[model samples]
Target: MEARLKFAVALGAALVLPAAVQGADYFVTRQGNDANRGADWATSFLTVQRGVDALKPGDTLTIGPGEYPENVKLHGFGVPGKETLIRAELAGTVVLRGDRDVDLDFAQVPGRRFVYIADCKMDVLSVHEVDTLTNLAPAADPGALEFGPARYWHDAEAGKLYLSTSDFQPATCHRYTIGVLRDHGVDMLQCRRVVLDGLAAAGYRTAVGKEGLLLPTSGFMLHQTEQCTVRRCTAFFNGSGITINSGVGGRTDQPGEGKGNLVEDCRAFANRLDGIVAYNPSGETIRNCQSFLNQTYGARFYGGRAGDAVCLMSDVLAWGNPGADFWTKGGGLSEYNEAVLAERCIALRDCNFGNFQHGIIGGRNVYRGDRPHTIILPGEHEEFHQFNDAHFADPMNFDFRLQATSSFRQSGEGEAASGPHPYKADIYHVKPGGNDDLDGLSLAAAWKTPSRAVARLKPGDTLYIAPGRYAGDLALTASNICIRGRGIEPVVIEGGLRLAECRDVSVERLQFSGPARAIRGGNIELANCVLFGQSVEAEQVEGLRLNHNLLVASLRLVGCSGVILNGNLHAAAPAVQTDTRQAVRYSSYN
Candidate 1:
């Protein structure tokens, strides 16, 4: 954008569309009995399942703060417009667990597989990488360890556990015993408009099948369902904290049966695999979420096809994760069209990320402390470290917040620094018939191409694109900018939109034709838009909001949080969302 042009504007006002239906609220308390009607706090239900049976449309099931060791299955307790809500009244104090404590002796061990764990304080071991008992040798120190502390090996085939003889005896195993006993904490199958909030889930272990393949599980899952939301929740020490599965093994190319999903203000940590994951495509919106200290990627987006998936995120942080704190590839393929956008996001202290040759990255993002400390701009350059910075308050403590004398906060501000630019509502104009020769001031003299127009824009500026076919690729790096189409005629773009180091961008009322992809941007929202040819992808971005859009290929979202979808999404191909809290509303297939 032009260094001289300056304007600062916040995002559009949130529409107060409508409110959910009012319904009766039920309570579930530990001190209550199963026979109670669960109508009021005075006479609440003991078991959560009994409370589920009594739910109606738009019903609220308030679970008291306590640990509940049981696998919950939520069926069709939701109505069409209104949703069924389940939440802990006290938030973090409530835990829905999936583990059972079992006292053990060395005699019960399958092969004397006991070993020490180093939680980055020294060399550590992970159970997933163990191949043989003989290989459990000691490491030199934390730097030499491939895994982090207090990890144990599980012989899933034999149902045996290998623990440190010095640290854990049957009497001392209570700490380790605070784990999962079942496969899932809450499972949703063919449900609609369901909301889960303020719950903590943990302690899930994998089991080995006949072929020795480890069968993984999730803390909370939505399988073959539509319109679900999870928020203000913590998923830890499980195989996967949260997952949106469409079919068995998450193996399906079908368009995401679930649509318009949202996840916000959640945390996932200390999980076996990824902290958060998504399948079933059709995408989701993520915002203001955090994932860290997990075994693998902090958040991973997958289980969809290349050219079919899109995700949006902004204002998110993924730190202290060994694997690339956030990853955005689908099941087995990495295509340019598929993407995840992360804006004003951070990826700190990750082990590997530079190897991603076709990495989907966009928007004004800040990345530091990673192995490379440089991000691949895909077709733009091999390495681009535009907004990344290594200086921080403290790295050891995972404090990535900028210090008082930080420069990042300075550069983002326009240096006219004090004046109003020559635009109203902080929006500029661009048109097909307009020429680039003029000052490009008004709609009548709008710029013809995006190359010159984008350079003249400032942060919080809006590019009002007029209808007509325009060619050539467009790149946007300015934060809080909106590129919207004028409604008089169909605003068609021939090429694609590339975003890097961008933030709070909204693309609306535009139609992307041919091989055009709005790829690799963060805090992005595409509403009343149609995407064809390639997929629309967002990476490393959080606070995504996608609604009322038609996607011909896919929408890919990776390593994101606080994702939400309103309604009216049509996907011709598969869709994917990885490492995110997902919410879907009233969207349907094409």
Candidate 2:
């Protein structure tokens, strides 16, 4: 583990006892067998459970880079001075998945538009797109599934999974993943002084209990754990993210065993419930974390909000959670009133509450949402994201990193400081006849295809396409990457680009000659481009900006908002056709 992951924010005075000598190190890998004792790399264990089961105080269980599909339970307690560590060999390389992969052989469902695979017994959470790990939309009826972007429906009674595909030959054209595990990824019960560093958990959905109540099945669930730390971890597509709960206990004002827990530098998104939740916690701290797009509240505290039970949250970024960005439940007691103390937080697109709960204090928060809720306090400040200004790099695609041009990049003493800082991204080049195997960092060693360059791009990176015609039919899932063409020689794409669920991407000085459904469910900008597609279509898009472009194709936008069309030449009759209410204008008609 890194030193930063071991560092803790102490809430009270603490004494460091004499350190116990370091214990043995155990290794786990996908290529090993469980019969091996996990003594070293050569004698590694196959299952993470076997490695964890063989741990002692001060022992480190180092997991190799691979997917470990198992439910891990930590029931042991570590001494005050000697803590147990469960860490990845490399940060963000190990995935603790709650789902198993299944090979589905699909066949056309007679006259229906969807395809079906039989003998699937498990109730799947979703059918995930292979590349991006994004869940396909769930269809209400299997018959309604279309031959387009993926969608799925499960007929549990018949034990079949139905899917919609891009082509008739579903198996050959598309790849997908179905999640079968419906339980907690990592459950910590009565664990003391343990550390979870640089791990990721995904694809867990809670089971239903009696009376149809959902059971607790978080990606990382800590119950009655004390002084434990979870840092540099990610949780997604689960029942809930990292949850710190008292389990079966009531709220208490006295110092309890469920205290001194820390969750920091973690990300939680796309869960069924709260991103990071605490129930009846005492002196818990959640900081420098991000939680977004969960079904419910982003970060929620339900009980134990008085006396020594005050939880602290700082430097957290939350957005797109339908419930609230940050929420705290007040027990209505006069003395036990304060539930949380939050500072230096950022919340956006939270249609419910925006960092405001009845018993919250210590706020230096920046927030913007359809509905904002907050309270003012001294030494604590608040800011809001204006619709007219750019606040984040791309919140639509869940990239909430602070842009270099954002005013919040440099903060004064009294302002709220949150979100990750943007760094200078390397520029990559692409040209026809270049080799995709070479590093696309320079023009001399440029990549061959736009698809190849797009795959290697980071959030802020730029891809420069040299003058030449290239094949398109590209599906862009990456956000915040700029793609530009050298306009001196008229670079062209034969098929056109497809933006799929991406955000804040910009294209400049490019030409598209083939039919295209150009935009889908994102914010994209096109400048100085020529589009000759039969019809350029955009659907359910958040923002679309077209500037100084020649569009030979008619524009069809449906269910879009925040669209701007300025100084664009349109050659087709009825140049723009759409259901969006945004005003559309063109500079010239040919």
Clashes of each: 71, 0
Candidate 2 residue spans exceeding 4 A from truth: 1-20, 103-159, 163-175, 208-215, 247-256, 306-309, 330-339, 351-590
Model 1 deviation from native, Cα RMSD in Å: 22.2
Model 1, 502-589: lDDT tens per residue?
A: 6788878777775433334456777887777566776666566677777776666665555555454556545644554452211222
Give a tens-digit lDDT track for model 2, residues 446-562. Answer: 689987688888998877787898986656787898888843578899877788888889988888887656456566898888988887888877778788888887888887776
lDDT of each: 0.57, 0.69
User: How many backbone overlaps does candidate 2 show?
Assistant: 0
- Looking at model 1, which ten-residue stretch has the lowest summed lDDT? 415-424
Candidate of highest TM-score: 2
The worst-scoring run of ten residues by lDDT in candidate 2 lies at: 368-377
Model 1 segments beyond 4 Å from truth? 1-21, 101-162, 165-174, 178-180, 207-215, 246-249, 305-310, 331-333, 336-339, 350-390, 393-399, 412-590
